[model samples]
Target: PTLTAGTVKGNTAGAFGYKNTITTDNSYVVGSNSTISADNGMVLGNSATVTGANGLALGNNTKVANDNAVAIGNGSETAAAG
Candidate 1:
């Protein structure tokens, strides 16, 4: 994966997008129809998209931002874990 290009299309374990992803890239899309672009990020969607270094989109249209983060479902943002 480059600064924005990682796909994990639909399957079973995950309705779409990436469910159990792990790595250090830029962007990552894990859905049947989604897009990602970031640095060390992840996205999981059915038809979503993401744009940015270290971002992620996960869902039908999720989106993410920042590095070492992750988005789940269509669009979103990786909030600091507690």
Candidate 2:
């Protein structure tokens, strides 16, 4: 489903020219051409990406670690002690 724009308290839209399929709880994100797979993570920018749980992300063209990691910023990333 194409979740459009809104200050929705629960659901949000996908990035521009993209699709939003993953579902999560307690997270925030914005912008286009980005990705995330966090259960309680957040992002607010363009071309950002992540594929982990309980993580948070921000900035443009960024990547995150998997398995309970937190990523932040473009070309800036990190991983947790898992």
Candidate 2 segments whose C-alpha is farther than 4 A from its true place:
1-22
User: What is the C-alpha lDDT profile of model 1 across 1-82, one tens digit per residue?
Assistant: 2223333332321223333333334334454555543344455555554455556565555655444556664345556556
- Summarize candidate 2's per-residue lDDT along 1-82 as a digit string, tens digits: 2345423233552332343334555555666555656666566666666667666666777767665666665777766675
Clashes, model 2: 0
lDDT of all predictions, in order shown?
A: 0.45, 0.57
Name the top TM-score candidate.
2
Taking every candidate in turn, the Cα RMSD to the unseen true structure, in Å, is 8.6, 4.9
Deviation from native of the Cα of residue 48 in model 1, angstroms:
1.8
